[model samples]
Target: MREISLDRLRTLVAIADLGSFAEAARALNLAPPTVSLHIADLEARVGGALLSRSRGRITPTAVGETLVERARRLLVDAQQALDDVQRQVQGLAGRVRVGASTGVIAQLLPQALERLGQRHPGIDVQVAVLTSQETLLQLAAGTLDIGLIALPQLPVKGLDIHPWRRDPVMAFLPARWEPPAVVTPAWLADQPLILNDSSTRLSRLTAEWFASDGQQPTPRIQLNYNDAIKSLVAAGYGATLLPHEASTPLPDARISMHALAPPLWRQLGIVHRAGDSARATAHVLDVLWEQGVE
Candidate 1:
């Protein structure tokens, strides 16, 4: 079957609304002959007269009125489809996929997402909670739009990475512990230590710190969640090394933070596809840029 032309449908609607071919031609910036040809061709295709001549105006015949009604709805739908595509291309509305580690999601993303909603209610943020390494993997795979990761992560090409923040890695000890002036590896080695699990970058960093002093830490327990370690440390189970920002509000009031002798830190950075500057992503970056990243 031959599909109807959108141009012809539009012409039909204009002619019917204006009540004359000459008037529609003027409104559409087309010659009257072109307008009359449009109507004549439409009538021939339908195998019936489509308009009736009044004293000085025109009216649609029964079939023509039916065609005009359908034409109006069809034209509206076509225009709507165009607008939706444009919005997606412009990032004016759509879902932005974001990947972040547990620490960032817990402490930072809540406020960021809240501000994002207030400013651009049309853009939705989809969050995935992954470790820093995992977050970087997803970002490189193109499954993530933005990634918030703990550094120093191994660098990868095709990614735009920039430092977001850095916080001191401190010794978390029981609130009433001697409150040492500076926590040295010697003191940490002697204590039953609760450290992050070996799989994480923070764990590796802490291990390197201990290794620097010719000491190998024998952790009483290794766990991934900072809060859990903070809780154990607060109960006097052991001292722990954790980023100050990651274990905020101090999971337990009984836990106190002290700096390392030489001061260790966990750095955070943001990652995204190198060439991706999506509107929603850009807007989110704008809000974050003002956050004093680095």
Candidate 2:
């Protein structure tokens, strides 16, 4: 079958709406012959007469009405597609896929996303909670546009990871427990601990901090989500180690925050493809950079 031309389809729809070839030609800025040829070409492609002229009035034949209705929908979709592309080209709109841990997403991403929405309301940021290793894999595979990953990662190919934030790891103990002014590994090791899951970088970092002083105490329970761990600590489950942002409000008053003796830091980095990013992605990256600490 012969492929139909959008231009001819447009001409047919215009003629049917105006009920005259001359009016359609005038409306479309085409000559009378060009309008006639468009209808003729369309008829040949479909093997049917598309228009009827009787008693000085023109109207679409049955086939023409069907084609015109469908063409109207097609034209609408085409115009929308063009508009979307144009918005992207103008750097005024796009969708950005972002990956980060549950903690960062809960605590930090909201501030950055709020700034992004104010600055570029047309840009949409879709965030996924992922582990650092999973985030790195997705970034390398070109699935994620931006990544907020834990630092101290082995370099992955085609990815550009830069340190973004460093927060001091603190001990979160139940308020009911008599906590030390500064929590040391020896002090924390003896307490029943509610800790991060073994998969997380924060878990490894805290483990290393404990191991440095030869204290390899086991945790009572391990979890991935920061808020859940904090809730457990508040419930007097056990003491836990977590990074704290100065500006973030503590979820519960029942949990006491204490600094680690040999202060351990939780580091985070942003990752993207090693080249210039799309404008929307750059906008999000700028907001994320603003969230970073020295």
In model 2, what are the clashing residue pairs, if there are any?
A: none
User: Would you estimate the TM-scores of all the predictions?
Assistant: 0.74, 0.92
| lDDT tens digits by residue: candidate 1, 172-225 | 898888855878887788888999898778998898898888889789899887
**C-alpha lDDT of residue 167 in model 1:** 80
Per-model clash counts, in order, read 0, 0
lDDT of 2 by residue, 119-172 (tens): 899999999999999998888888999999998888888889899989988999
**Candidate 2 TM-score over all chains jointly:** 0.92
CA lDDT for candidate 2: 0.91
RMSD of each: 4.1, 2.0
